[model samples]
Target chain A: MSKTVIKVENLFKEYHLGNIGYGTLREDLSTWWAKVRGKEDPNSLIGHTKTITNKILESHFLALNDVSFEIKEGEAVGIVGKNGAGKSTLLKLLSRITYPTSGSIKVRGRISSLLEVGTGFHPELTGRENIYLNGAILGMKKYEIDKKIDEIIDFSGIEKFIDTPVKRYSSGMYVRLAFAVAAHLESDILILDEVLAVGDAEFQKKCLGKMDDVTRNQGRTILFVSHNMSAVQNLCSKGILLEKGAIQTQGSIDEIFETYNLNTHHQQCIKLDERIDRTGNGQLKFTNIQLINANNQIINSVLPNEKITIRVHFRINKVININNVKINICIDNFYGARIAVISTDNDVNFTTNFNNDFISRGYIDFTFPKINIIPGNYTIVLYSTVNNELSDWIKNDALTFSINEFDYYESGKTSANGHGYIFLDYKIK
Target chain B: MDNDEKWDLIIKPAGSLNFNLKELLHYKFLMYLFVKRDFVTYYKQTILGPLWYIIQPLLTTLVFTVIFGNIAKIPTDGIPTTVFYLIGITFWGLFSESMSSTSNIFVTNAQIFGKVYFPRLTVPIARITSNYIKFFIQLVLFFGFYFYFLFFTQYMKPNLYLLFVPLICIQFSIIAFGIGIIISSLTTKYRDLQFVVTFGVQLWMYATPVIYPLSNIPSKWLWVFIINPIAYPMELLKYAFTGQGIVNFTYLGISFGTSILLLIVGLFNFNKVEKDFMDRV
Candidate 1:
């Protein structure tokens, strides 16, 4: 059994919403007076719960609230969470980039974080110079960089442009060089945050291999944070699931993934209008989205070739005159790669209904008599545009549903095996 | 595990002012690399390259000579106007540039500082060290002019006080760095201080007698000039080169004491802010 290398206890971090300094001298004086009187800070709302309403009630944001965990030596722990789940804050605290508002962390050895690769790379500096600069920034000594410069160059595969300024290097080469330096850093504990999300598939595979070697062969403790479930399952032996500034569960990788999937897929209908994480002109908004079977019963698990209808209820806040208004819905697999796009542009009645003035609230029904897809969880991205130009609203991950494995071709075979993301109908001749 | 066993590192919200001297000493090579990066990248894309280092103070000296020497008729204590103002501007350039850049260390490098962990003091130290290269180049230019004036005219004079040049340089660096880090700590939350720093350093130059000799000030007002910490270093530089200007031991003592005080305050504040600056910055 390995000894514990990192121990974090009761960590909490709070952040002010706006300027750290009070906006006015009067506000500052008032706060100072409150402090002198031993009263609660006039500007702080530390214990208040945050609501998803339009009113911005609280000024203090709790980024991490009483989070605690321990990592043993040589344990590869994957931190998984949705956006705004405090994953980055936990990593930041561990790396000592920021301190917790309270609590403590004890470490037994040197730890380096590749929160972002090539963080301090100066664009004007040559690739070779940036290598030294980045290496030093990551706490590598001068002689260590000099000894490993050749290996870094060879691994990055940019020897021809080593002397060239990094500003001129293509973005692919840039990430390659940056990841190379970070991968070569010799430290007892390594922290990585979504670093493999960049580069092509082959490069990502190479990085995964390198990460595996670093943990399994070198016996280095690794803390990895990513939304890529498959990659996390491959590289991490343990897992931590963070939800809303708190750790929801911690266990083996499989157990954590199972808990995560169950928690995220519990909600069958998504109240899109209540979601705060969206971007658009705000003229139109998705009110609710639900997946229903042919019997009009709400469902979250559907088999391939089953008749399903996606009902997207929307509200037009303001009446606008537009000729070509269309809704685009894209289906993305669990890895966040788009599988297919279903748009209303091909429907002849889409433009006719939007031209009327009284159409403020309506539902757009997409009936897929025979859904074609593999067995996996999927998300939908819904967007509406006017005149094929300006986007009125766009909501990502508006709805999520899982596809149950089924033999659609009646051959007792499903695409859940070694096949790809889509199922094709076939016959043995 | 033994109860007395010590972990390699323990992180907390705040720490005492041991200054982490051992950690800093261990990462000395990183400091050197930061200094080298600053030097190399400062002139990376410029066409004139290192010539800009010479050109900056040279041009400033020329402009000051015409404005203060000829137009304003400022006295230089009988030394040639060119060499006197050159020495003043060169020394002052080292102090002021280091001070201003060091004061903005946290703001300018917030991106890198937020992403990685290192001794934050290394950045300010590296800046002061790298700037010495520019100061050295300008020093060579000053000496070239000094030799010309010494060989060609009788107005030039040399004295044993010239040996104090190294001490004066170190004193100047300590004072500037001390003040710089303090302002940097405050500016992380109150960005208005950044603007105040720019205007204050400019006004501070006028108060330090960079353009005129110390002798030009009347005796009754001498106390006002002596209180400014930079005035001591400026007067020392002038006395070493031209063999003129006041070299009062009492004034130097006051300046040195104040610098030490400022350094303690600066380091305490820097250490305090380094823990949580990312929260605000």
Candidate 2:
């Protein structure tokens, strides 16, 4: 077996939430030291200083707590997590862009990270010059960049504009060129953070193929962090899932994915008002959401060819006259790709009666004629706008349901699982 | 202690004051590229381009000669007025540029520094390196005027003290870089210091005897010159070129020692800050 190339022990990262530069170093360090030793803070017990001490002690929260992991050489590991899950913080620590608050990480070789593409790019410089500048920033020697210049330019597919200033290139061209340079980095370990989310679908596929080649053909260890599970499942053999600054699970990619899905699925039945991860103006708020069938029966799951009705109950917290209201429910697959968007504005203005006068509290029902989604778990986003301004929005996990498999043509045949996420009508002669 | 296992790198919460010369040396090419980028982009879209380097100081020299020499009647210690002020401007210009640029290292490079990892010292060192080139250009221009007075006007007496010119330049770069990093480290927390840098250099120029001769200062107030690290080397440059200024060996020694000490403090603070500046920046 290959030796462990990376080892992290009892890592902890804590961030102060409020003002950071107010006090002297001695005061901050002493207070921090006292707290780290689990002793009463030096300022906490003083008479008439209780408020100051509370502010000092309550000002920080841990971003990562007692996290530890090890990776062997040539293992492609995927780090999966929700927002603020400490995944980016872990990547930042590994890349040495920032140091951890405590603990130690030992590594055996040079590590290159693509935290952001074209990190040091100068727009005044031509694309060729930026290549060298960016390459040098990534720890490549001049001669190394010289050797790979032609290959990088060709891979970017913008050879004709290589000598032009990058400020003149379109955003697409810029991202392509930047990713092209980063993809050619020669290092024993590569850490990536959602760098493939840019560019069009074709270029994204090309980047994925190149990354696959990097891991499989070149045998380099990779630590990838992304919300896109399908890409993670495609590239990584090992997986590590993080939740709220702690590791949820670690094992094979399939097992980890199953664990992650189960966690998201558990949140499906949660009440909308109880969901704290929502953002909107308090003028309107979604209170509850339910899925019902054609016979007016509430259901948690639906069949492939069934009529589905999504009823969204909301409350008006403040009295305000609103118009041009649009409500959209976007259904996304497990991979975070949008499958369909059902909007109230698709057919006609449904709120003509309440254009001038608004309802204080009521429910809006959206009924779909037929849902032909494939058999899999999916999530939906709840969004609404009043007069082209966002009034309420609840992103993924606003509601989640699984599609039951059924024979649409009644021939006892099921569609291939990996082909697509939707079913449409067609008949063979 | 895990003596059996050896890893290439070990990262901890706090870093040491140890200077990693090998690591800095390994990134020499990056320093070179930074210097090159600074040189190329300094005047990229301008009409005069590099010519502006010469034009800026000459204009400042002319203004100083008129105001300080002819109008204020400041003595040049028998050296020609134009050459005296030009030499002072050349030296002071480089020193101020190096100091200001060094101090702004954290604020300017915060974008790249936050995302990538390399020697943070390289950026400031590269700024000083490139500033030296601009200094060199202005030095050559000063020489052109010096030779004109020496050979054509015959009002100059030169000596072998000119050999100290390179040493003076090196000391200026070091002192500027040292002070710059210290201020850069502090400014990451207190941004008000950044506003102080520009006028601070201006005030520091007056203390260094850039526009007047050191001989004009009263003997009782000369201790400020003794402590100002740029004073001796800058005085030495004028004395070296014209052989007409004071050169005290003890004060020069003290200046050199202080510069080295300042650099150590700067490096210590800079190393401590660079590891986690992103959080604060």
**Which candidate leads the pack in DockQ?**
1
User: Where does the lowest 10-residue lDDT sum fall in candidate 1 chain A?
Assistant: A48-57
- Candidate 1 stretches with Cα past 4 Å from truth are A19-57, A269-285, A292-309, A315-332, A335-353, A356-359, A365-373, A381-398, A404-429, B2-5, B14-18
For candidate 1, write residues A246-356 as lDDT tens digits.
999999999999987776565434467777666566666677888999999999889888999998887776766645567788898776567898888777766665556
lDDT of 2 by residue, B69-121 (tens): 88989998977788999989998888899999899888788888878888898
Which residue pairs in model 1 clash with each other?
none
Model 1, position B123: C-alpha lDDT score:
89
Error of 1 at B147 (Å): 1.7
Candidate 1 residue lDDT tens string, B8-117: 77777654454778878767887887787778778887899888999999999999999999999999888889999999889999999889989988889899899999
lDDT of candidate 2 over A315-406, digit per residue (tens): 87666554556778899888877899988787565666445434654777888788888888888899887667787888758888888878
